[model samples]
Target: MGISRHATAHWEGDLKTGKGRLSTPDSGLMQDTRYAFSSRFGDEKGTNPEELIAAAHAGCFTMALSAKLAEAGHPPARLDTRADVDLSMEDGPALSRIRLKLDAEVPGIDEARFQEIANDAKENCPVSKALSAVPITLEAKLKR
Candidate 1:
């Protein structure tokens, strides 16, 4: 059977000025977390879908990279990844692009091999596959 995760969204009102709460019951990390139009479009400092997606992507990609590196006999000492989701309001708040920046410290890996493995991890990551419709770019650096 395939693994499954679920989250709940509760909204009350129209899109422009509606209030929203997101909850991840299983993990309890997000219990009735606030999300709103101002938070998404403006500077309300709450959580948004794009931000969530970015977090998920970053986490998934980093983990995948770790696994891949270990399989290749080069387990990483540290892997820092940042994911950015760009929202284009010109087309009604569509996700335009995504950028992933990864900084890694591996014991013994060459640049070419690291690049190949990083690209493979980015391509095969579950979150990346789910968000395949959006263009994704990656910048990976091997920290010395």
Candidate 2:
């Protein structure tokens, strides 16, 4: 069977004034973390769905890149990835695009080869595959 993970959201009251708590029991990384309309759409301090998605995408992409590099015999010394999830209300509130910015330090790998690997990871990563409906862009930099 394929791997499965789960998180739960507990919301109270109406949308505008309601508050919610998100919890990931398995990892315990998020325990009753607060999220609300203000935190999502306004300047309130809390977690939001887009931010969570970005975090997941960034983490997945980074690990995928590492794997790709290792498979290519150019294991990375370090890799940093940032995913930006854009949420817009065109027809409705939808995830319009995702941008992945990756900075990698690999010994003996050229820029062209690094770019190729980064592109491959961006296209083949699990998270990228899962979010295939959204437009995904990548900016990769190889550092010496």
Candidate 3:
């Protein structure tokens, strides 16, 4: 069986000015968070889907990297990841690419090995697998 997670979004009115609330009952991390067209396509002070996607990607990649390092017997002391999701309107509104930047500090691991593990995580992480259709790039640095 597979685990399931749920989040709900409620939207009212037309697309341009319509407002919506997004919530996750299980974690309560999001409780009626607001989003709208402006929030998505403009400089509005609210959350957007792309931002959320970036957060999820960053988090998933970080965990995956840690797991990979641990399995390689070079567990990381710290792993900082930042994911950037690019949405473009070339053909239409689409996610063009995702860039993952990782700064990792792992004891007794060479830079080459750390890079190999980071690459593996970027390719095999659950989120990365799910988003395989999108172009994903990784920049991993081993911090001493």
Candidate 4:
């Protein structure tokens, strides 16, 4: 069986001064948002593509890292991951770079083994696979 999720965004007015709201149809959480050419072009409110990408990256990397740790027989005591996605307007809303920082506490794991798993998770995470056109950089700290 497969599961599906959905989100919807509603926009009104012009691009430079338009506003909208985004909601998770399944969860019923609606967030007020606004987008402008100034924000996209001039720097202004609302949400942008980079923010969405970051959300996806953060969730995907965490799951991937957890799987890696479990597969390696270490099983993380704690894992914290963050991803920062960069978007350059010159080339549309494409991922330019992803900054992934991970902090993991895994018992009985050596540095080499930890690094290998972290690197593999960074490179092979579902979001990473989907955004193969972009470059991803990883910074991981592992502790016993």
Task: Specify the highest-lDDT model's number.
Answer: 1
lDDT for each residue of candidate 3 in 3-86, tens digit (9 for 90 to 100): 999889999999998999998889988999999999999998889899998999999999999998999999889999999999
Candidate 2 residue pairs in clash (backbone atoms < 3 Å)? none
Q: Residue-wise lDDT of candidate 2 within 36-84, one digit each (tens)?
A: 9999999999999999999999999899999999999999999988899
What is the per-residue lDDT of model 4 for residues 43-118, given as tens digits with 9 covering 90 to 100?
A: 6665665777787898899898898889989888998888888776675655578899988889999999999999
Q: After superposition on all CA atoms, how large is the RMSD of candidate 3? A: 0.7
TM-score of candidate 4 to 2 decimals: 0.84
Q: State in Å the error of residue 39, model 4.
A: 5.8
Q: Rank the candidates by TM-score, best first.
A: 3, 2, 1, 4
- Measured with C-alpha atoms, the lDDT of residue 62 in candidate 3 is 95
Which portions of model 2 miss their true places by more than 4 Å? none
How high is each candidate's TM-score? 0.97, 0.97, 0.97, 0.84
Alpha-carbon local distance difference test for all models: 0.96, 0.94, 0.93, 0.80
Candidate 3: misplaced stretches above 4 Å?
Answer: none
Residue 29 of model 1 has an lDDT of: 88
Kindly give the number of clashing pairs for every candidate.
Answer: 0, 0, 0, 3
Which lDDT value does model 2 have at 59?
Answer: 95
